[model samples]
Target: MSTVMVRPLLHLIPTVLIIAALGLSGCSTSKPLPRQTAPPAAVQTDPPAKSHPRTPAPKITGKPKTTISAAKQSVLVSERNRASCYRLQPGKTSTRMIKKHIPAKKAATAAHLAKKDATATTAKPMTTVTRMVTTTSRCQPQSLIYARCRTGIDTCKLGDTSPVQWFACAKNNSATTFEPVAGSVLVLDRNARRGMPTGHPVYVEEVLPSTDNIWQLRISHTNYDRKCHLDQDATVLFNSTEMTASFMTGPWAPWAKDLKALGFIVR
Candidate 1:
């Protein structure tokens, strides 16, 4: 009984030993499962990148750049030319130097001349000129007797036949005085030099202010310049002491003289 049991056990042992040997051989020859030492620490390296072909750089084209020295030389030359125009003092620019060089008197004179020219160019006041007609005669033959027509007094009223005789006739008919009065007749006796062959009668228009021994009279008369021509508002000078009348201004001014004044006939 013991022997039979031993023989079966021995057969099972051989089978077990064979299986163990196969396991050991597999474990040894399997390359240790490629050293699963934590999967070789998971070798976390990235994949290599792919390379591309390189391209050539583009070339630049233009005018050449100016040198710094040449640029600086141009700026210096321009500054020198500008500086030559003015004699600049220390701490003064060209503008200040030019202002300082201008003379004050010349500036003032220029200003004065400009003002004078402006004044000269300005408009002036217009003057009106009156022209008198000297060639025409409008006086009537009877109106040539100036004192009689102006005063509306006839010779009959003055106790005379004509104006020439009125001065002497007025002594009896009207008042006769040496003093001049407006609306009175001033009589002058015959005087050849004054061109009075008979006598002259002037109507006194105004007795102006007297100066010392002279009295100014504004008189109106006819036939003084030309026959039957009336002269109005003529200036006459009278001497109170000499009792003479002279024309101050008129056509008769050239032949002016102190003519004998008979008197003024007042009516």
Candidate 2:
């Protein structure tokens, strides 16, 4: 070993020691490196966007067009058909003229009815009933032979219950006197010598108003024609005074000019 080699070696030792110390100091003073992370796994995110609801398109229908065409065609076809039937030749008659001249079909039913009416005409043809008339007699008095008195008593049980004498009926039944009622009886007690013995009775069939207060009474009776037979219904005037009178005068007495009309027996 040489002295020179020893000295060189010592110097190399010092340099190495200083370099190591410097390296250690740099390591302690220096900041640590930041840890790197994978970019936050690409967070799938989206920005808010406006939303719109879908609207259905309007539907178009072919109904109206099809119907209109069909109806128009039908009307045109009908007019064409009618024109064929109604057309008239230049020299011939029109359909209207032919129809006017055409004879009506035979009416067997009408002919039969006419024949029946003719056969019935032999036995007093039935008169046309202008107003309704009941076939049944309306009178049902409690105790009286006179038709008028009987009718008064029966028709109105509450009224005319008293058995008034035929002559005094007007005086006795004044309270019950009213307008003529259909099917009520009228008594004729005018004169005994005039062929109206005791009293003649007539039935009222209908009452027709002539004015506000005046009325016409249709009446029927037996022997009105002096032939001792039932007479057809005849109309006679009933004045306002007679409406309230106990007994009104009737025009259809056989022997007397005026017949007494007993008050209607109606409550």
Best model number under lDDT: 1
Q: In candidate 1, how many Å is residue 233 off?
A: 0.9
Instruction: Look at candidate 1 and tell me the lDDT of residue 133.
Output: 35
Q: Which 10 residues in a row give candidate 1 its minimum summed lDDT?
A: 50-59
Clashing residue pairs, candidate 2?
A: none
Pick by TM-score: which candidate is best?
1
Model 1 / residue 61 / CA error / Å: 99
Query: Can you tell me which runs of candidate 1 are displaced by over 4 Å?
Result: 1-144, 155-160
Global Cα lDDT for candidate 2? 0.46
Distance from true position, residue 179, model 1, in Å? 0.4
- Give a tens-digit lDDT track for model 1, residues 192-211: 77667667887777788788
In candidate 2, stretches whose alpha carbon ends up further than 4 angstroms from where it belongs are 1-175, 210-212, 225-227, 242-262
In the predicted model 1, the residue pairs found to clash are none
TM-score list, all predictions: 0.44, 0.31
lDDT of 2 by residue, 1-267 (tens): 699789989879989999999999988666343223333333333222222222222223566777878755643443344223221112222232111233335443555566744664343323332333334332232112333332334332334343334425444555344576654555444445755444455555667765866677765554433334334445566554643222233334333433454444332
Per-residue lDDT for 6 in model 2?
92
